[model samples]
Target: MENEKTGEVLRVASDEERDQAIIDAGFIPGWIGEGGLRPEPLHDFEPDTWNWETGRALLEAAATSINPRVAERRNIRMANSAAEKRTSLNTIHCSYQMVAPGEFARAHRHTINAGRFILESKGAFTTLEGKKVFMEPNDIILTPNWLWHGLGNENLEAPAFWIDFLDDPLVAALKTIFFEVRDEDYKEMPIKEGSHHHIRWRDLDLQLEDLVPDPNGRYGKRLQLQTPSIPTMRLYIERFDKHMTVNPVKSTANHLFICAEGSGTTKVEDKTFNWQRGDVIAVPSWKLFNHRASINATLLEITDQPVIEALGWYRETTV
Candidate 1:
């Protein structure tokens, strides 16, 4: 397996070697001892960014070379390889996905929850269970854990692309990863010609004006989108007005933020990075950070708070 972060190849000469490697990585038959210390540090202190330009170039190349090789799937993830994902302490996975015209991503269900933020699409839709959910630019779609879902691009002249986010790390840690593919393609039933009422994540439209200011006044105006389909996670859209700066606060859980619109500068402790639309930023657990927008900015924030909070291990403090 190719390790993206270190550019190293991990060779597995035999099944025994692979199983031993998996066990050495902190699991025994899919179970980790409750009090055993991890061999690896769970998180990275320095934040990193995945530039949109690089991602697009990779995706375009993948659409040609990689898309055809995999059956009903073509994706480039932001993490390392399958064995070592460095995206976050929680192992949140983000990827750029593409499906050529008339192509289909085979129907499958998994124990790990997932979501998609459609960046570009034309006549693209996903079938979750038996309902057809249309994809439009900026539309967010939910594919909850254990739900049978598949993707398709029906437009003849164009391909569709989107950002895929999943809580695979958490599932891997729990050793509860489960996946199954359907034997046949999921047929989309006909719907009212213009109705978009079946779009699950689109159920609530974002209205910035309707949001009350954050009580802490740390983050500027904010709107939290609850994806009931994936009840274990929460998503937020944070808005920063021109010249506005957010107060520093320690993160209670790992967060992956994508600049959906405008430009800004984020400071994680002493390190800072300038970000614009399409750039992704990862904030590992316990990092103190804040941001200032050069212009009005909007970010899509995904976090592992649901799992952390459930475990009663989440914490945060604002100065």
Candidate 2:
């Protein structure tokens, strides 16, 4: 007989000997042994580190990964996250949203605030409320908490890619986080052009001749084109002539300004920062500021004031 331990010829063991060997190995015997021995618990655990480069690679992989049949059935083409799993508390969920030409992601909204940055495709715009802002590669769109919005691909041959960021912790903490599919699937309104009913990039470049300045000493023309009741607020691009100035806005939330064309300087508090096209600047909460654009300049400004007002936290002062 071959020995099981050494693979050498040996005599076969009897049942009694086998039982003896098991006892010698310090293991409980089956059926009639003393109470089973307990093993040590593995209590100490460590989590993996989060890396930016790894996150980028993982996102890219997910963007190109094939969708499983089950996912396809549910319209889940690609679902991935910065965390290892969707349930992980320490990770950020990043899903790759790819809409084929002429497809839509359906209108939806959640308690979590989200922002989407375009990675590819043209002729697609996100309609927030009634405003349809055309998207370009690297264009960042903000989807504030509880705002109804949708994305539509107008191009016939290009796929659109976007990176979505959400307030994951807040959603998970409140347990009120959810996404809803609207009955209409998409907003029923047509895309408005040239600031007729919506604010467009081109319309922002025109002069502010129609804006009548306030008699109350407010600097920039205080025309109430879009009000907080409208759900979203937007401002067009135009240069502030050499001496023309804007009064500081003292508000609870911050303001986001994107330089779409030309160069300029923004005075925030006592600091002045120069800005140019593609530059995004955030005016911190409760700060006093004004901007001066060089030559022929244009800017796109989006702020959280309207959203804050809806929540009853908006405050402002004029200087």
Candidate 3:
């Protein structure tokens, strides 16, 4: 065992008896073992994809078994395939949530910052900060940390679905998680017109009509969403032309992409993940990846790049 650790070590402490005494004193020999400090950032998440149809089917099935009134929220978390991480990434997390027709989840607030990308909606609304803001397909609605919000669907004909992204993992890791549920059912809220939290799809689509791909052929007609309130995360939309393949890039930030429309394949390292509308792909930190569209496509990219950059740990290499 002594010869097993053959790195540069100093002769400060000694003997088996002394080591045992140190252990008994509630301390380990610092000279032993390569510890938690790594040469670079390490993560359990890997390049993985989640099919929308599968998630929708599961959620649709859960509607009959998992009651929102009892379950509180009907969501399927996108746990990572690598290391069974039980999270989409180390710092970011995602879940596919559904609110059945005429069902509403009670109002709740938490210290974890969160937002959602609407996948299917009609007469679906979120009572955000005590006011109603209706959701539409492809819309992005933000619910920052500690902001009171509740979800519901007024449409009796169909259910509503959305992908919820959060900084819960980071919050939990920091041991600062705080949560509370409202007293009464979230109902009869006043309507909020042109709420700052709602980013309508109509506006974003109009902007993308004349947008151009990046000069370096990395990103498509990309749009960086203004989200100064959530300092831990950033949002973006990258549109790609039919059959267009973007250059591969590796970065220190975790990346999660939701296919807003069309079909495409994302190559992460040696693995290729094919995605279509409503599909999601998770590319863990420091993974080399790129996207190629089989048809004109739009992707919603969510990343913790803001926190990474803020900590002066941002790095990227494009090839």
Best by lDDT: 3
**Model 1, span 63-165: residue lDDT tens:** 7676533545687768742255554445576877888877777778899998888777898988777556778877777788898777788888888888888
Candidate 2's clash total is: 2
Clash count list over all predictions: 0, 2, 0
In candidate 2, which residue pairs clash?
A: 204-237, 237-299
Q: Mind giving the per-residue lDDT tens digits that candidate 3 earns over 72-174? A: 8999999998865888988998999999998888889999999999999999999888888999999999999999998889999899999999999999999
Query: Which sections of candidate 1 miss by over 4 Å?
Result: 1-46, 68-72, 80-89, 183-188, 191-206
For model 3, what is the error of residue 267's alpha carbon versus the real structure, in angstroms, after optimal superposition?
Answer: 0.7
| Per-model TM-score on C-alpha atoms | 0.78, 0.44, 0.90
* Model 1 pairs whose backbones collide: none
Winner on lDDT (1 vs 3): 3
Best-matching candidate per TM-score: 3
Candidate order (TM-score): 3, 1, 2
Which portions of model 2 miss their true places by more than 4 Å?
1-107, 111-122, 127-149, 154-177, 181-197, 201-207, 212-218, 221-223, 227-239, 242-253, 306-319
RMSD of 3: 4.1
- RMSD vs true structure, all candidates: 10.3, 16.6, 4.1
Q: Whole-model lDDT, candidate 2?
A: 0.51
Candidate 2's TM-score reads 0.44
lDDT of 3: 0.90
